[model samples]
Target: MTRSAAIVLLLLSGCTLQRPVPSEPDATPMRIVSMNPCVDTILMEIADSKQIAAISHYSQDPRASSVPLKWAMQYPVVSGAAEDVIAASPDLVIAGPHVSIQTIAALKRLGIPLMQVSVPETVDESKKQISDIAARIGHRQTGANLNAKIDTAIAAAQSGAPPVSALIWQGSGLVPGKGTLADELMTRTGFRNLSSMLGLKKWDILPIEGLLSQPPAVLLAGQANMGAGNADSNRMLSHPVLRNIGARIKIAHYPSSLLHCGGPIIIKSVARLAEIRRLMEAKP
Candidate 1:
């Protein structure tokens, strides 16, 4: 039997001891496949358990997943290949913005429908995306419930504390600037992004030299606890100049996981930001 046929046979046979979600079905279920990690998160929130045929393989990796790996592992995974998608037998496939032209054409040729979602730069955009994706999945009320959760998070994260100047430092000298989701999160958590003073754009590099001069009251390092193997990033973090600023800047962990993608994740991201902001407030 061919590889695809063999896999189909495996599904057809009674060997489902290892796979979490089996691939056999009659023709009545709504099997939705998510090819993006962020999309995987949103789908988990709005779609019924039986509606999810497969999720992105990325969600299976704790290092890259936006959702909890323990939760995501309960579903099947596909690595964004047309063949893999076909094996899942999806009625609709939702993908991230970076889908290749070839993959799109292949899906089209195979008669599988595709929906692509882009990264939202702000919280409002993220809310709209959640509702829209939920609507498309035929669970409009569930989508509204998710959006209500975001609204609650936003309200709870509202801070009366003064806007302390801060910079969200990610690995390799990259920083989030105005109009990005990180920036909005910081704003809501009582942080005023210092990247604006350095004339940075939406997403730009803020070198160590710039850090020495334009220090903020708080430095939220995205890779502070991780990415130790990145030699160049390590050198930047361990720079002699950065060592001397402890008395002036409050360096704290702002995990790289929160840097990209927003869905149900916005709640956690905003909460962390507020926690750090409150820490800063408690100090002189």
Candidate 2:
């Protein structure tokens, strides 16, 4: 064969010799499983529904869910059980700070891609968690958008008024002191956290007597109506004394739902807080 004939033969048979066009990358969605309720709320905000195989069953529970129950019920739920996760056959599993060690070990043993997140104690930390989770699922821009919403809300709620002494009285007089997202949020909304002022730690129980001894200017009552029929849950919040001493304090209902997670909920939480603060200012 002549050189021209050989060249044509090679062109026809040796396609690999031509600068191979890089094939388009696989477009398969990353099948993600979330074993934590907090992360579930974040995923619901940043990831596509098709990407999520299952979210933590806790997100389905109204008492524990950070997101609205109606919205959360639309997704499948897993119990954070190894068997449940394996059955989902997730391409990646995201666990929260409280995920069990055994489950982590099992996932590692099975050679599954896994990522874990911690409870964000500050606003910056919460945003970072959102960014990391979105990046893992290839939704970085969505995460950034959500973060921007948080910043806008924060700016809008940024209070220039003087800080009024306030206490976040959750069910059974449970209080979140300094070093918590709640504490930081209170400051952001222009309220002095009375829990920290009383020398409380990160989380502590504030007795009724303690509250009465040095009542704050505002009371941000949380979870007051969670278990309506349960006396145990209603005891402190429903006490007659609180009603009688009402005029001395600015009482507002800050629900337990808003206290749980920080992602999208922070926007609502901050707005509510600012509204409450404005109410206090409107009053004497």
Give me the candidate number with maximum lDDT: 2
TM per candidate = 0.84, 0.86
Instruction: Please give the lDDT score at residue 239 for candidate 1.
Output: 70
Error in Å for residue 109 of model 1: 2.3
| Tens-digit lDDT track of model 2 for 1-284 | 95435434544464333222221233333678889888888888899888888889988876577877887888778885666776676778889878777667766755677788888999999999999888778888999999999999999998898998999887777899999998899999999998866878899989898999899998887635555543224357677898899889767878877776888889988999999989888985
Error of 2 at 45 (Å): 1.2
lDDT of 2: 0.80
Candidate 1, TM-score vs. the true structure?
0.84
Worst 10 residues of 1 by lDDT: 19-28
After the best TM-score superposition of candidate 2, give how far the Cα of residue 271 lies from its true spot, in angstroms: 0.6
Sliding window of 10 residues with minimal summed lDDT for model 2: 18-27
